[model samples]
Target: MEQKKRKSSATIASIETEYVRSLQKKASRKHARKIRLYRRLTVFAVVAAIILVGMTQMYMKQKQVLEAKELEKMEKTAQLEEVQQEQEALNRQLIKLDDDDYIAKLARKDYFLSENNEIIFSIPENKKKTDKKDNGKE
Candidate 1:
């Protein structure tokens, strides 16, 4: 009888030790899982930040390029308008040159030409007033 009682007590002690060991293992596994989860979250946050910064830089660069193109477009438009105005003035001069009367006047004034049996007279310009002003300034 005493032998049976001792055997039962020893068995209960072994079972209690096993239960305590299992509990310790469970706590350790939970702690390790928490650490792993924290590490994963940290890595995810870092990667997200890097991606955000990269996208922002790309957007800013593209915006700058677009602004430069817009400025170039404005400059080209202004130059085209100026060229068109110059072309209009040249067209007007071309029209004037096509007239016979204008051509005759231009030839007489610039080349000292005259028609047959026509008389031409020459007169000096009034340069004395301009000369006096220039002499005083100089």
Candidate 2:
């Protein structure tokens, strides 16, 4: 009966040791899982940061290109407006040239022409001579 009692005590001690070892193993596994989770989260954050920076740079570049195009459009619009004004002036001049009176006036003024049996007398502008005499008197 004493031998049976010693054998039972030894069995209980071995079972207790086995239970402690299993608890230690489970703690180690939990620690390892925590480390792996931290590493995965860190890697994901770095990749996300890189992607965000790249997208911002691309957006700025596209904005600059769009602004340049808009400026060019404005310049072209101004140039077109100027050309349209010049074309309108030329059209009015062309219409004026179709009138006989305007043609006669242009010829008489620019070419010194006169009608048949009409005499032309030439007169110099008196304002310049008068201004010169006035200055001399002063």
Winning model by TM-score: 2
Error of 2 at 131 (Å): 8.7
Candidate 2 regions exceeding 4 Å error are 1-16, 108-114, 117-138
- Tens digit per residue, CA lDDT, model 1, 1-138: 999998998888444688899998999999999999999999999999999999999999999999999999999999999999999999998999999999999999888899999888765456777878899998
Over the stretch 1-138, how does candidate 2's per-residue lDDT look in tens digits?
A: 999998998888544688899998999999999999999999999999999999999999999999999999999999999999999999999999999999999998878899999887766769778878999999
For model 1, the stretches where C-alpha displacement exceeds 4 angstroms are: 1-20, 117-138
Best by lDDT: 2
Residue 35 in candidate 1, Cα distance off native in Å: 1.8
What is each predicted model's overall lDDT from 0 to 1?
0.93, 0.94
Quote each prediction's TM-score.
Answer: 0.62, 0.62
**Cα deviation of 32 in candidate 2 (Å)?**
1.8
Score candidate 2 by lDDT: 0.94
